[model samples]
Target: MKNNLTSQQMGKIKNLFADRVRFNKVERLVYSHDMGMMPEQVRALIQCTPDAIVQPISTQEVINIIKIAQEEKIPIVPRGAGSAGFGGSVPAKAGIVIDFVRMNKIIDIDKEDMTATVESGVVWQNLEGELSKRGLTLRTYPSSSDSTVGGWVAQGGNGYGGYEYGDFRQNIVSVDVVLPTGELKSFSGSEIDKVYSLCGITGLM
Candidate 1:
């Protein structure tokens, strides 16, 4: 598949997300593999050396990279911190490994509505320190200081507080994702009734 990538095509993909994204030697060395826990065969696979590490600064950059990866039929693996105990971050195929750590930004907070817009890399521990002052929390939170909101959500995580605040899946207000085909989309949040009505219809029904 890589053989089909013309010089021009390669340049385009590189530039598509170049503003804050990058392709570098150091990136290859670090993100080429994931940090998987011991005693699992899965660890061998996630350690595949990616040809490139794509750091998307925004949702749009994510979409652009996915589009080109799709064109090249490159395996696009999404990743955050090296915290997937299941070794999901291990890329079996050498392709594009997207690191979302740089996208960490708190876009907005609506105290009246009790909602906050944040980038995927917002650490669970960091979120707690900020939200605690407002008498609120992520509802579902990973105990680890380095755990990211997106990584936890992708794994459908649950916390000890699940019985009250709900599990990781339930606590999420929404998610903006770039599909493998390069579609930028969001679920929940403003798509809902614009209020935190826990008892109301799930809006999914």
Candidate 2:
């Protein structure tokens, strides 16, 4: 994480993002924690208040936000439902939180390939329901099916249906990512492992 941005830096973000960027104290506090279990001492002493929360509704918006953050050297925490039982989405330093709830559209569902292309913000249960309507279902999903697709993929592969279909990594055919430096790239096959490891640390999910 990086230190809080200067007002000038924040002004640039606000001008570019309009209402999608929030810096109010109430909203900042809301994005500071997750469903993770933390020690009382740690929780009481350190509230991970992000400098700002940015909600991007599309891939283009994500790319734009990443570009700004990179130019400003701001650390970004990409978040989904924040349900991982760990503080994976919590910003270690006060910086920017890219909350993906609005980017939750399922982009594609290919019955022929038995695959779905979803934005990272999509919820697993919603996808499961949609697939079932088409006489299909996910090979695996978190027991907390409400967890977002990006969040599950980023946190490493472990979930329900693992005994049969394996984990998320096996099911994920490829991923489209915005690199930390703000470049867009697609990774598939064995290459995806490297991308997965980078997770929220090095790039957008």
Best by lDDT: 2
- Estimate the lDDT of model 2: 0.84
lDDT of 1 by residue, 59-97 (tens): 777777767876778776677686765545656666677
Q: Please write out the lDDT profile of model 2 over residues 1-205, one tens digit for every residue.
A: 3437899989988987799999888888788788876777776676477999998987888888888887888878999999976777887777889999988898889999989999999999999999999999989998888889988778877778899988788988998888877788888999788667445665787
Off by over 4 Å in 2: 1-3, 40-47
Query: What are the clashing pairs of model 1?
Result: 46-90
Q: Which residue segments of model 1 deviate by more than 4 Å?
A: 1-10, 19-26, 38-47, 189-205
lDDT at position 43, candidate 2: 66
For each candidate, give its TM-score against the true structure: 0.76, 0.92
* Residue-pair clashes per candidate: 1, 0
